[model samples]
Target chain A: MKDSSVAQRTVFFISDRTGITAETLGLSLISQFEGIPFIHVTLPFVDSAEKARETTQRINQAYQQDGAQPLVFATIVDPEIRSLLEKCDGFYIDFFKTFIPGLENELKMASANVMGRIHGVGDSNVYNTRIEAVNYALNYDDGARTNGYDTADVILVGVSRCGKTPTSLYLAMQFGIRAANYPITEEDLHSTQLPKALRPYQHKLFGLTIDPKRLHAIRSSRRPNSQYAQLAQCENEVKTVEAMFHQENIPYLSSTNLSIEELATKLMVISGIERRLR
Target chain B: MKDSSVAQRTVFFISDRTGITAETLGLSLISQFEGIPFIHVTLPFVDSAEKARETTQRINQAYQQDGAQPLVFATIVDPEIRSLLEKCDGFYIDFFKTFIPGLENELKMASANVMGRIHGVGDSNVYNTRIEAVNYALNYDDGARTNGYDTADVILVGVSRCGKTPTSLYLAMQFGIRAANYPITEEDLHSTQLPKALRPYQHKLFGLTIDPKRLHAIRSSRRPNSQYAQLAQCENEVKTVEAMFHQENIPYLSSTNLSIEELATKLMVISGIERRLR
Candidate 1:
């Protein structure tokens, strides 16, 4: 038999959303336990009872073979399957346990304070609506683009080569944000004002600016040493565009060192965009 | 001035990857502390001293205007920029702060253990290599198949219509795993073995299966009522494929209810793939 003291504990993440959310959350939790040797297993989309049984059997086998109880970190939404997992012989950390309590508390608190305009809106419906809205925003543009800027949850503005595309795409894919980005040209910078239509929705405007050197480097990779990829031009354009944002009082973030996830999340938080999923 | 308790706190996510990673981590952390009124701002790609100074200025302004200290959660890579953020009058939580001690401890432990394979691999080099590998894996296929399976960190096996594409992509983008997927056809299922070459790398093999009904539903979305999308056929195929996996003793995860994120994270954990980034 393997030494229980040193034998790595097996942890499983069973979920419906491909287990990425659970896995990411689990990894963060595992990081807190510094010296623990744990083997993590992710069993995603195990919706049916049969699959649950199979997973349980595998967990039992792993424990029996190793003489150590494995930890199962799960985000199972279905009631029946979650019950099935509960019967398994292992330590389980369920995200639903945490989510339900928090959600219930929020609902209770909100219901008590019936002063808000949308006070009577049920929490479940609100959450569901937000999720649907996010999904709609994400898949809003298939190809054809009419000037329907009002539909965007957040509008990203930046100069050329300011890391707008990736940031927009990341927000869409990760958080289901319908993030629409428009590059501020030299003309717009010189004009010293945002688009006339954007004036009313300035609250939704978020700007992205990058260092000219970095922009030049990124652009040079795509079009080496071209006029568009010149360091001087990039620097000048970035400065002008940033000045325009400052002059117009448009809040902005620099894209020189931040990751796409950070930028999107920050925008969501700042813009009061509630996340659809935890 | 706004009521101290009612005023929204400013939260910042600063990172090199447009703050995407920091934002994801921060969201998870914030989720743990529900009901905290905080406004999040992302300073992505803030790799320079000038940009950091600008970020500091924003934080200072937010504090002075709001009458509450801003909470900064940063994932900066540059030491100089990180130091600059540290001096900012806000509650700072750096990703590197959580990772560095653990990494140092890991390095010391590895170095002490003369037989450890990672004894000489510096943490920075490992991180850079993993980032490069992840990027390489993400763009592995320009939607075109090549003989790139040889370099894959993990090869996913499943029947057609089972979630292989999204899971593979998530693995590549999130953990930087070069994930290549191959569909197991009836011929292979009947043969009761993985691809002959894959047998040698069984340790890196991951299998994704789904409920027959769900598989039918998914396939029907693509091809309605056809034999390929028939429930009976799907049931038979799933049974045959799962039995084949069981017979071959290849561990697998069901993809019926799990999300893409959960599946990728579970695979990373179960397959013993080391995470390069926190």
Candidate 2:
């Protein structure tokens, strides 16, 4: 019989991906409702209808016991499961329903877009381990005399300042891939060959090539407008790097307009690393 | 179909908090299953039964569509809501159900151990913030001339090597609180008074008093068996520090037998910071 207006609401986030992504995203969304006091619960990685049903019953009992209704925010990817949740006695917000329509519309607009099963590379652990290995390789310094090319999980050969460090670190931190990068110096480029130690790990090698303009912009951030950061020189260097990758048949991804996530995802998808995790 | 061995399971973590706690704990549990390839999803912050139903339906749909059954691992505090989740289409594991029995048994064993619901601590954020604040205060190092005593979130005025730095850093890193510590030098001991700057923030302050033997062991890790790390001296220092805290009416927790997490959790609960987040 207290003021009805002051009643506190409870909220839950249900997802299939350890609920970390849902929780992270939900935290931002909840921040929008600053003043309302709400209780939050997270149910993560629920992968079955039986578990879902049990969770729903529990929610129903909580409502009956507390004499208050609660709200649920869910990101369930399966459709039949969504119907099971619909029978519950409380209010619910489904994220997939909200997002799917938009995704479908985008797919329609791009008629030629590829539709294929997204092969997951392995569990988070395998992906994380590989990323870590790559990072360890890239950060190896050998007293400025020799390239620390031996330690790379995947030694990426490219021209100077071609989106190596950040990409490597992102892969390592997010996915745990050990990435190493070695710049194809002028001598190596003149010979048109990868460094000697890289030969043994050629099967694990990848390359990144970017437009000189993009490279110049990226380089300019660290050292503004220097000769080393010149656009024309960058373009020339990129052309040489591309030719080398093409000649050596070292697969490369363009860094021109790709986000780090997109680049990593694409590389992971194409590199046959996705299926090797199991 | 291939031999009907156990199909891979999907695990769910449901929580009233951000699900971070459940996820962290669940991850540790799942890590025990070395060869199993299971999917993990999180449904965070489910506040009500209606929402739980919607989420349950989604789980059913996933079962129907993907043919992947799920297992739920949850930490739902509200009983009625727990029943709702139990009805879902999966095997379920609830942490509260698992822990409550033990807790009840403990209560029955020790009636004197009962502590009343101190105050309504809102959530974990306030607890974390206070811990961080205390840590930041302790770690603030000013130039050799003057002490950085004014900047502490909670100036822990305790004798030398009295479990200050480790506790402070743990609070700050885990909770993002700005913690600072000030040593109770011999001059302060002679005067037998808390620092002047700590007066205004007394409510926010916390004290950690440990047994002298425990304090000596902790100190010996840094400088082995030195006079500064002596058990007798440590015992005397602890005695003096406890007397000062008691004289000033400042509440404190013992660090003698508590793990860092347990210590921090107790401090958060006792200091009334947990209620602020809710």
Candidate 3:
């Protein structure tokens, strides 16, 4: 492998819970390396020593078959299980062991050494908050249930198919914020004033706009060849919505090249909405 | 500072884009240290030197006030701006710098050194897939558009408030999978048979059940004092759903103490649904 005999390597993300932490940090690190192709295998819920041994067997098999030591990234909290994984025919990168010692040394404290906590439902309160936020987002989606705008943490206003719904849902699910989204119709854009229903919650209002070409592509997929999906219509709608945002002095972001996660967190910072979870 | 004079440390999550990566890795490492309270601050979209300078001043101010080197976790990829930030009076954890050089030496290729592309909209296809999946989940939520069941990657069947809606949405939003959910009514539960509409899609079926007490609490919030919120009703529904799942050989999981992320990914593994993104 050092002589470049193999271009691809097997990478295992092992965790006692969901393996999300292992996969996340492993992927971020792997993305830094450009030429080496990695085949990622995420093995979750490996909580028992038996499960760890089985996973170790798989890792050894990968090493044998590939004729190179595999890269294993693990967050197993149990020392015995970590030792078992360490004995495998792989270059082990223990996320917990690597960072926990440094932190313990820094703070002069011991870690909890528990499993299934990070990104897991070990905390009932956090789980309930996420579920409640999801429900809230679903109920208030697309300006469907506008009665609870007073309770909303933020209100996203945009033209049809301008990424309001997904951004609202993402903010709710990830941040535990109740986000209500209202569609900015042509009438509202023409009126040059905030919607009658949203006027009371202007402080919580944020706006989204998108590139006309991309919006046209998205709208065309939904309603093919309709006047609504025409390029001119998309262009007109985007310009009008952005102009309305400017006139109203409402902070806005363009969704042309943005993901829902990006839009959600950015708008939270812009509108000063507090995220419920750390 | 080494004598541990400070009770709390100021931590800044700075990035050229959304700052999600910095926050995520920083928080994960921070959690391992049990007792030290951290004042978490996020500064996003610091793409210019001016913004970097402003952030540096803020960091210096925190250093002066706290009388300790502030912990600055940065994901900035711009060399010039990063050098400017390195001049600040803080302990900087440069994510890009710490890992990219090793990668370049390993792969014998220089990094792109670009900003804000990892979690941003650098890949339009990925962004569109997420949006498309979210829209599908919303449209197919709660069996509202059950006719498209044939197109679903997985169909979740459960009683009311057993976490079908949130799990379906989470799977779609995170994995870009088309998920359709159906609610099992009392009639179907009593009859001890799968819903007629879901019979043909049995191979794609997955089930979710929850603890009666938790279900009761959840239902009570939505429909207080109703028969639906009664503990007996919740218990009966759970028993019926589990029996049906067992009889039909449909793989199932408990949502009682699981987060939506866990439920979504685990069920995807059970149902063999492929994730759209790497």
The lDDT per prediction is: 0.64, 0.56, 0.82
lDDT of 2 by residue, A49-115 (tens): 8868976886687567545566666656566676787677766666445444433342232122111
Residues B147-189, model 2: lDDT tens digits: 5545444444466655555455445533444556556765566
State the DockQ of every prediction: 0.07, 0.02, 0.50
Candidate 2 wrongly placed segments (more than 4 Å): A1-19, A23-138, A141-151, A274-278, B1-5, B8-278
State candidate 2's TM-score: 0.38
Provide interface RMSD per model, one decimal: 11.4, 19.7, 2.3
Models ranked on lDDT: 3, 1, 2
Each candidate structure's count of clashing pairs: 49, 148, 0
Cα distance off (Å), candidate 1, residue B196: 12
**Model 3 clash pairs?**
none
Model 2 DockQ vs. reference: 0.02
Candidate 1 Cα misplacement greater than 4 A, ranges: A1-152, A155-174, A178-206, A219-229, A236-251, B1-138, B141-143, B147-151, B157-161, B180-205, B219-251
What is candidate 1's lDDT per residue for A137-245, written digit by digit as tens?
Answer: 3333221242666777777788876756556655654555666767677666667677665677687778888878878877897799798899888988888878778
For residue A68, model 3's alpha carbon misses the true position, in angstroms, by 6.1
